[model samples]
Each structure stands twice: as C-alpha cells, then as structure tokens.
Target: MKMNICMVGALLLLGVAASGCANNRDLIAKSVIPARNDVFTEGGNGAQAGRAVVDFTLLVKSNLYYLMGTYGKHTAPPYRAHLNIDGQTTILEADPILEDNNSVGLKAPESGTGWKYQFSKRLTLAPGKHRLSIALPIDDVIVEREIEIRPGINTVAVTPVYKRKMLRPYKGENFSAGVKTVEIAVN
Candidate 1:
C-alpha cells in the first residue's frame, strides 16, 4: 500500500545521494611520488631543539605540447612560495636546478647518462605549526598545506596535480581555478 511506496522512494533517494558523494571523492587528481611512508627517507638527521629546518623539492612534469611544435619549450617555470608562521607571511625566492648536459625534459638517456631538474630552498623555522603555499602557474593551481616543525629537518616535495589531458586549448581568460589541500609532511 502507501507504506511500501514510501519505503521504495526513500531508498531511491539514498542511492542518488551516495553516488553524488562518490563524484566528490577525488578532490585533486594527482599521484604522490615516493608515497607517504617513504617521504622522510631523504630528510637526513633531525634538527636541533627549538630550531627546525625545512628543505623543499619542486617537481615539475614536462608538458607534452612542446613536442608538437618547433618552438623551444621551457622546462623551468618561475613559482611563488609563501610561508606563513604565527600569522606572518614570508615570500621565499625560487631558483631552478640545472640538469646534467643541459637536458630539458625526460627523454631517452644517452648511453649511461641521466638527468633531472627541480627547484629547492631551505628555510629555518621556529618549532611550531606553519603553513606553506606554492603557486604553480603552469596549470594554474595553488597548493597549500599546514605542517608541524619539531626540532628536525623537514623535507617537502611539491608537484602539480596530475591530469589526463596533456594539451588544453587556449580559452578566454576570465576565470578562476579551484583550490585543493595538498599534503606536505614535516620529517
């Protein structure tokens, strides 16, 4: 009777709600390298008491569109880094790491030689909680995270969110991108 119809309708509504939640599960589409358990392997020894040092490793994936045209593509792009501690924000300078033999992107290695490139910076921070934000313009994404510093050398590796589409057509410019929480660990 009427009770049976009401129960069926309620179950249908619940099913729809669960499917919507599934779509929102993946906020940022990217694979984390080194994994979470292995991030502390490269941080070296811990820092001294009352003082914490942070080492940053920037990883930028090569854009595949560069191979389509004859124009030279730049592998290193300038990035803006902001570190906020105790309500104070500090802007850090970014420098590019030169690859071996001046190689650009990841390609076939010549004989036994290999090359890699990235930007790195070290910051001395007081023992406590701090927030770090990195703005990467290549894909118009900003990564933000909160980290705890406790008498040790902390290493953070940053990279853009992975996307399946390699090439995106140029569109009209009046738009804003979404913000997602990027995980950064303090070793």
Candidate 2:
C-alpha cells in the first residue's frame, strides 16, 4: 500500500511540473508575437504630423583586419545587423565609409588599431514606449532594452566598448575578448 501511495505522489508532482512548463511556453510565445502594424517608417515625412523621428547610429569595429606590406592597410568585412523594434525585425548593413582611429577619436593602442564600420537609419515611429533589440550575428553581440520615444527628433547611439578587464593597464584594444558591453544613449 505504501509503495503504491509513493508512486501516485511522484506522478502527481511530475504532472504539476509539466503543466507549469506549458504555461511558461505559452507566455513566451505570446510575448514574441509580431506587431500587427508596420510601425517603423523610414525618413522624416510624418514627423510634423505627430510621429516621432528617431536617428539611430550603430558603430562597431570590423571583425578582421589585414596588414598590407608595412603600411597596415585595414579592410572591413561585410558587417550586417538585425534590429528589432516592437517585435518587428529589420536588417541593416554598414555604410561604405570605413573610419579609422583618427575619425573615431580613439587612441591607437587603446582602440585596437582597427577599422570601424558605421550604420545609420532615420525612422519615424509613434511616440510611446518601445522594445528595442539589436543583434550583430557576426560579432556575437546582442542588446535589448525598453525605450521611450517622445515627440520630435530623437537620437539613439549604439557603440561597442572593450570589456572592463580588457581596458586600461591590463590590456587595451584586445579583440580576442570580444565585445562584452555595448553603450546605448538616447537624446
């Protein structure tokens, strides 16, 4: 009799755990549902009509750099990013211009002496709360945050920074550590 009772108890616990997992899965699915309407419109056409304008910029170092002869000619790999806002995903590619340490305002030794790629987008969105996500698949960098878009023009800047341990006296400009922190600023 005791053996049968223990088996029943274990079965009951397993059923409850399974049901809890199902509930969590349902919640996750609901949260990721795509937006019903296309919210991100390019350019500033609707800004005066009450839509908010957002100028977004993303800057990151190229994954690989080559030294040509002794001049150290740097080349930028084709960098692409996936940006998701309000459950809608958009793909963005870096601009043709490749900036160096001089234009980026970073010291050579500290900045890794690499070419930087930049991506910019001007978007018009409804003024309200938004969920923003950025993923750089090649660089293995992902950032997600909640942003409030107010009326008029807004500037959003996203840039990758060296890991804490990789900076300063320890060792600066080390790409081996990869990008651990991405700084986001909205103005």
Candidate 3:
C-alpha cells in the first residue's frame, strides 16, 4: 500500500510539472509573435514631429589580457551590438577603441590595469516613452529599460561593473570573479 501511494504521488508531481511547462510555452509563443510583428511595422507618422537625440555609450573590457611582462601593445577585439527601441532594432559593429584609467567604483592596482574600450552611437527618437534594449552578443550582456525621451539631447551609458567580492583586497579565491552585472544609466 505504501509503494502504491508513493507511485501515485510521483505521477501527480510529474503531471503538475508538465502542465506548468505547457503553460509557460503557450505564454512565450503568444508574446513572441507580437514582438516579431512589431519589428517590421513602421512606428508611426511622428517623423515630422519634435524628436529627441540619445547619445549611447557602451564601455566594456576586451578579452585580451595585458600581462606585466608583455612586449607589444595588443588591440582589442571587435564587438557586435544590438540597440532596440520600441521594436526598432539596429545592428552595430565596431572595432574597440582603447582607453585607459576609466575604472569605476574602485581604483586599480599600481600596475595600471584599468583599461577598457568604448563604443558609442547617436540615435534620434520621437519624443515619448520608449523601451530600450541593448545587447552585446559577444559579451553575453543584455539590458532593458523603460525610458522617457524628452525633446533635447539625452545620454545613456552602459558599463560592466565588478562583483562586490571581486572588489575586496587581494583575495585569492575571488580574483577570477570578474564582472557582476551590466549597468545602464540614463540622464
């Protein structure tokens, strides 16, 4: 009798898990179709109206590592990015521009290891609320925000920040725990 009850309970749990997965699949299917359609359709006739300019900048570290005894200067890798606003998607690619001493939150070691690359874009958008999505495929970073674009110039900055544990001084185990999150700030 106990064996039978255990089997029945297992079957019931399996059924519930299957049903939950089905419901999630249905929800994703329904939502994806509309988003796909929105990408193709024109936004509206608001092109002649007042517009706002968005200056977007993304700062990320290159995959290349500069060692203490490195001989020559190495160039950063190229990156591909996607900027989507209210269903309008623009694909961007750029060779990484090398920069130095642009660290945030904490100061770097005396070896002068604070180096990064910058990618920038200027977008003209209609004055209204917008859904902004930024994706860096190579870096596996995606950030989404609901932003209000007023008439004038606005700035959006995307940066990769280090994890809290990684910021601590000279911890052996946490040394490899790099970026914690990608932060997006608008002003």
Candidate 4:
C-alpha cells in the first residue's frame, strides 16, 4: 500500500513538471530582433547622379572614404571622387580602373584620404581645407566631404566600411509562391 502511494506521488510530481514545461513552450520571447532593412531604389541617369551625391556624404565621416546611400543600389560598388583644390575640381579615376573597380580603393598619397586615384609620385594637396565632389558610377548617388591637409604625417581611421550591394529589382510576383509552413514533433 505504501509503495502504491509513493508511485502515485511520483506520477503527480512528474505530471506537474511536464505541464510546467509545456506551458513555457509557448515561447516567452527572450529577445525580439526588430530589424528593418531600409533601402533606396530608383532608375535612370538623374537617379544615378542623385546617388553619387548621397554616397559622397557618408564616405568621409568614418574613413572608408566612399559611403553608399540608398541611391547607390543599382550597380556593384559605384562611385567616382573629385577633389576641389583651391578653385580647381579634378576628376579622379580608379587605379587599374577595371581591376580594383576603385570601388574599394582607400589610398590617397596626397590628401591621405581616399579617392579613385593612382598614387603617381605622392600626388599634391596645398595646405588648407579642400572640398570633395564625387561622381556616381552606374547611376549612383553622390556624397560630398571636406578634407584638411597639413604638411607632415597624417592618419585617419577608416573602418566598419561596407561594400554596396545591387538593389534587387521589384516586380509584381507572388511572394508566397511555394512557401509552406509545417511543424514536426521530436521525441
């Protein structure tokens, strides 16, 4: 009789524990990742030039030299930089243009910043502050920045830089074409 009572008590405890775990299986949501993917998508030359202007702004702040905004979504890493020395604005091209894509070039022997340029004899930048005007490649947005030059060794931190990804074209297609939701049980 005592053994039977003990069995009943153990069963009751086991059932209570099982039920507690089952109730918790509803998911208490330890962390909710509310992440949003904000993007920009437009087509045409006007749109591209607009992108170049946007990229020029974010590039200089952190050091990557060329930051991409929403407008630079169409092409694979698109941007051309132009620096205004005094009153002259010179267009700089990527070195080995096709090889590096200058898309990721961050070397400027002159200003020591970044420009789509080849370091041919340590470039030239007069003492003072200069303006940068970047061109959009493949219809990219433009972002502008200002750089200061002083005669001597200068260093800038350019990290956390991101490469631009092509904006996927939007078409009226079924988003849930073949997606199915199913659940299975494991023992």
Which is the leading candidate under TM-score?
2
Consecutive 10-residue window with the lowest summed lDDT within model 4: 178-187
Ranking by TM-score: 2, 3, 1, 4
Clash numbers, per candidate = 1, 0, 0, 19
For residues 1-187, could you state the per-residue lDDT of candidate 3 as single tens digits? 9999999999999999777534333322332232432422222333334776777787665433546744222334345556777766765555544444434323442123333456677777777788777765443456668888777777888876543343565532221233434678888
In order of appearance, the predictions have TM-scores of: 0.45, 0.64, 0.55, 0.27
Instruction: Give lDDT for model 3.
Output: 0.55
User: Which residue runs of candidate 2 sit more than 4 Å off their true CA positions?
Assistant: 1-37, 65-77, 96-112, 164-169, 173-177
Q: Cα deviation of 13 in candidate 1 (Å)? A: 31
Model 2, 115-159: lDDT tens per residue?
556788888889899988776655556677999999989999987
Instruction: Give candidate 4 regions above 4 Å deviation.
Output: 1-80, 95-122, 153-187
Residue-wise lDDT of candidate 1 within 43-132, one digit each (tens)?
A: 234565666777876544332122243322334543344443333444444443323333533222211112223556666666676555
- What is the alpha-carbon lDDT of model 2 when measured against the actual structure? 0.65
Q: Over the full model, what C-alpha lDDT does candidate 1 score relative to the true structure? A: 0.44
Residue pairs clashing in model 1 are 47-152
Per-residue lDDT over 1-187 for candidate 4, one digit per residue giving the tens place of the 0 to 100 score: 9999999999999999777544322221211111221222211222232132111111221122234631111124433333332334433334322122234332321122222223111233333454433322222223335655444322222111222222422322111111011111111
TM-score of 1: 0.45
